[model samples]
Target: MRVALWLAAEVGEGGRFVKQQLREAMPGVEQIDRRMRDLRPAGWAIMTYRDRAGLAPGELLLEKIGLPVWEKEHRSAGLRVITASTRRKVFERDGNRCIRCGILAGEIYPDETEVSARLTVGHVEAHKYGAPSGEENLVTECSRCNETAKHLAAPRFDERQVWDEITELPRKDKQAVLAWMAAGKREPSRVERVMSHVWQLPGVQREEIFRKLGRSLS
Candidate 1:
């Protein structure tokens, strides 16, 4: 809590600070760096140079301070102690793909080619009060989607912009989109469900299956 107290008292919101400053302030305290990151889920907004322009490397901008974790009552806020078994079950259930965007591990995003997706387990209802850490409450998500879901940091399209595109779709396609919205999830089609399993096959097994399917088609 010393790190939190230091940030709260010393580095108020919209303040700029460096890593060295934090290190020097908390001498001999192992992993004080990680403590700063732990505050993020609790609503802290510490941005690196990559997150914002005009900042030098190794400098961070404290945009917002969330959930006074230094306080006694809020110490455990946003902390989810998920078990290993639960994590494995959720990943397996989701076919090791991000349930939010259906992106698989190490796959490049359609628009962003800079970094590939990495899988992580994320809560379905993030920041929900008294949320359980069970498999039912969790889903597989890419690191990007997990971060987006947490803060909704990405740019959002206006309802009119989205409605314009939706209106242009065929009636059946529009109905399909509405069904997905109402259900809060997009159910994979038969081909998609089969392809999801196929994508997980080993290289040799995948090649053999491909040859068999090709021969059957001919």
Candidate 2:
């Protein structure tokens, strides 16, 4: 029982079940085959190494997925087509850093295969906007970050509607509303408020924004 619980903690969920088991039973633990079966619900997955003894030095295992990635498709080619390019030129141009996040591929990832063309090339502008094909519009993104941006990028909402909704709220709420409307809330509250005030005061609502994003900010 102790061995099973320890195995679960080390290679399985390692959650409340394992903690409870340890508290209830302690001292000498032996092997770990008995507790493997019937431990998890159908999709409550756990990952493990093939064998610890065979592992190369400094090669460790990932024992849990934590969140399973349901890959709908390898999106790079589709995105390239959408952008009217056989290859995303901007990814080649930027040297594999997400244009928005400034994360370079070699900086964080371990896979040499992922360092170049396999790195996700994200669109700085909307794909619907002529599906920008030029290198000026593409940004290198990791698949994870690209997934997040794609999930967040939906149909546009009216900024006027946002102002009307939050005009009466506290300054903080007003900031939240503006931040929600911006391109991923990259700026601080104070910066947004000042920008809004500047735009509103001058009656030049978003010309500056267009100018700002017109070229590579990188």
Candidate 3:
């Protein structure tokens, strides 16, 4: 609410601001950027340099004001509290991997090997415009993708390059890719599904299962 008020009264529509100003205004408020981001769901049009050209890094533009959440009647506007059960269901449905990037929980990122991926639930659609918190609307996402998606930023990969790579795939792989695109989420292969399940077992049980599988293969 304070962030909304500050943006509206201080920054005004189409005004440019920076992180330092926000910190100065809110002084010691934890996750001020996150607080500002929460307003996006309520119709606020805050734009970063990625969304708007000519702005330097760390600068932001308040393009429009959103819901008056401070008012009693609109306090809960554009926000939905997801239940714990729904989170569990979404994680299970996504095979405990990031549906967008296919990174498993605690796995190191392919690009940034030093950093491990952490899973979180995010809307399959843009949650900023009031996407529901139901299992159907949710999917497991890595922390990196979740932040990027919420900001409505351009994807890290080039579209033409991605398409070119996709076109070069073998016929069976192409078909699998097509299936994943049609479903809006990748279906883990049988082996991957089994591995996901195995990851959930106790350490000793997992070792026993792996040993039995090795014996069978032998």
lDDT of each: 0.76, 0.43, 0.77
TM-score of 1: 0.72
TM-score for each model: 0.72, 0.27, 0.63
Best by TM-score: 1
The worst-scoring run of ten residues by lDDT in candidate 1 lies at 75-84
Local accuracy of candidate 3 as per-residue lDDT tens digits, 24-122: 998878888668766655766676665455888789998767788777666676345566687788887777899877889889888774567878778
TM-score of 3: 0.63
Q: In model 3, which runs have C-alpha deviations exceeding 4 angstroms?
A: 6-40, 43-68, 71-74, 83-85, 111-118, 125-131, 143-151
Query: What's the distance in Å from true for residue 121, model 2?
Result: 1.2
Q: The CA-based lDDT of model 2 is what?
A: 0.43
Query: On residues 164-199, what C-alpha lDDT tens digit does candidate 1 reach at each position?
Result: 999999999999888877876546679988987898
Tell me which residue pairs clash in candidate 2: 98-140
Query: Candidate 2, residues 1-218: lDDT per residue as tens digits?
Result: 33333544554543323323443465453322223322211112222222123444433333322212122342222223323252346655554455454455546443233233225555666433235555666666654455446543233347787567678799997876566557552333476456545655544546666566676574
lDDT of 2 at 8: 43
